[model samples]
Target chain A: MHNRSGLLEACLLILLKENKSYGYNLMNDLHKFGFEEDSLNISVIYRNLRSMEKRGLITSSWAESDQGPRKRVYEITADGEQDLKNWIWMLKNRKSQIETIIEKYENLK
Target chain B: MHNRSGLLEACLLILLKENKSYGYNLMNDLHKFGFEEDSLNISVIYRNLRSMEKRGLITSSWAESDQGPRKRVYEITADGEQDLKNWIWMLKNRKSQIETIIEKYENLK
Candidate 1:
């Protein structure tokens, strides 16, 4: 199987692609999909969010709050949308490759 | 696209998935596909490798080297092979998602 980083990052992007969210929100949402494990590190989420923001794939704004601290809400940008499109293309391309490998493995088995 | 981490990590896994290779080899090979940029940080490779190994998706061993330190070569484990399957599955599912987003973006454009 592939490493967890891509899946986790892709998932968070997909989530923000749908709507704006905060770091904790992403953590909670992703947790439902088996992202709560050690492989899905909490720091990874923050790191990806910042990295994506720097790439112009996502943009974030701080929401003023009375309690705790200001929450950073991230929204997908236009470039982010296109980026997601490319990611989708990568996924489609990997599909064929995986099929080939699976067939080969089955044959070997 | 969907945050550089996933693409980079996935690309790395896809590399090792082909055959066992060392960190530098994986980094250099991935660099061939636009991974040399800042978004594809070098440390990220080792981090994902460790994470993947921890998940039981990959296995690694130190190979004796003549020129330098022992080079760590990693191979996909049985579970890792299965994990790659799941990763491929995730990619396939994202295809439809990206298509829908593209059509929407085009309509807005």
Candidate 2:
């Protein structure tokens, strides 16, 4: 029931690859990519982070932040990079299928 | 876990809208739309058909076919048309988000 498109995980990996980011900053970045705040909850982000770390796709380090509490900054691993590539392929595949359906529907209209 | 993109449902609705179809013919049409036979199981199609009928999105009638066994031909209902529109909107929304992520990654590379 969570992100059937798997966009959230892809975005997280891409953002981590772009730069090491903490959960709070990642949450903010998600908004920039069109994710709703309700859908991109803090707990959901944390859960995915933990799962990704467990999968050896990402690593995190606790760092002291000047304005707030210590933050866990995450960085994508080599495995994570490869996984992102696979996800990209899957997304492209799904996109094509969707486009085909849309085309069929438009023709019907 | 089934069709996170909801493409299957959308395709079925669109096909039904185009013409009333029996389950067997629908399976063949799916191949034309890029769905692999292995991925598009007959059972999966029936399950969706039953679910849609239960939801009042489609209606089916048993018919006698001269060439083979009796088949239940399905046609989209009024509610189904509305639902297809909603699915189209959702698909477009998800597509935009995926494109943004792909763009960001390409820029990173």
Scored by lDDT, the top model is 2
DockQ of candidate model 1:
0.09
DockQ, every prediction: 0.09, 0.65
Please give the range of 10 consecutive residues that has the lowest summed lDDT in model 2 chain A.
Answer: A1-10
Name the candidate that leads on TM-score: 2
Model 2 has an lDDT value of 0.86
Candidate 1 wrong stretches, greater than 4 Å: A1-109, B1-6, B32-36
iRMSD of prediction 1: 7.2
Superposed model 2: Cα runs more than 4 Å off: A1-4, B1-4, B65-69
List, residue by residue over A43-72, the lDDT tens digit for candidate 2.
878998999999999999999989979999
Per-candidate Cα lDDT values, in order, are 0.66, 0.86
Docking class for candidate 1: incorrect
Model 1 Cα shift for residue A86 (angstroms): 12
